[model samples]
Target: MTLNLENEQNHELPSDCEETARQVIRQVLASENCPYEAEVNLTFVDNDEIHRLNREFRQIDRATDVLSFPMTDWESPANYSCLEDDETAAGSFNPETGELLLGDIVISVERANEQAKEYGHSLKREISFLIAHSMLHLLGYDHMVPEEAAVMEQKQEAILQALGITRDPEVRS
Candidate 1:
């Protein structure tokens, strides 16, 4: 998988933030059994930028911790069979790299830091959690309802746990 990451914000992020994001994305894809070599774009932004994005794209006036913009809509999460059959399949693959273009993820580092403090967790854990959650969305997972939310929560926790990142930094399983 190829991850194109850009840090547009000036926050003092963790030194290993980029690697952490790559690891979380890989874990999510592995857990979902994604079939293709994937490519994704990740951008870190400040709260103002995120707030603008949230309002423009989602019509939400408030800023969120993370935003996911998936390239394809799937019948089932991470099922790439439909893409293979699609007439636009040629457009889905990266021209030079030949990897399936997953989508773009925009994260608000300022918001994540605030949430980490509010939730009593390390910044690394909070950022990792956002990456995992956004990856699930890119794979077509949603939390519109309780059942879906539960599934997403479970999957997010599993992904983080696999990376030894948890809500409580003192504990790891």
Candidate 2:
């Protein structure tokens, strides 16, 4: 797996945040039992930039913590598969790595920081959660309905727990 990360914001994010995000992505993919070698592009942006993206892509004017643009379409988790030979899939692959391009994840660093404070967790934890959530989106998970949201949430929590990324006890109360 390769994570192509770009920092488009002015914020001085911690140097290790990129590496941490990569680890989180790896964990998510592994937990989902994804078979294909994959590549994901991650961009870190400020509130204003993310707001612009949200408006352009989703027609929402507010900045969001994360947005995922998946390259492939799968109906459900049970039927997840990556077809390397398909023309649609082939067009996205990296020739050198032969990794299937999973698509992009855009994260607003400002929103993430605010969410971490609001949710009483560390910035790393919040970012990790965002990455995990986005990875699931790339793998055909959606939270549009109650049942779908429940499943997605369960997968996110399980991936985080497997990574030993539990919320702090002090933060829970």
| Highest lDDT model number | 1
What's the lDDT for all of these models?
Answer: 0.90, 0.83
Instruction: Give residue 92's lDDT in candidate 1 (0 to 100).
Output: 80
Candidate 1 lDDT over 1-173, as tens digits, reads 99999999998888888898999999998999888899999999999999999999999999999999998877888778878875647778898988988899999999998988888888888889999999999989999999999999999998988988878856321
Count of backbone collisions in candidate 2: 0
- Model 1: weakest 10-residue lDDT segment is 164-173
Top TM-score hit:
1
Cα misplacement distance, residue 29 of candidate 1 (Å): 0.9
| Model 1 Cα shift for residue 10 (angstroms) | 1.3
Clashes of 1: 0
Tens-digit per-residue lDDT, 23-105, candidate 2? 88888888887777889999999999999989999999898999999887665652444464476566667889889778899
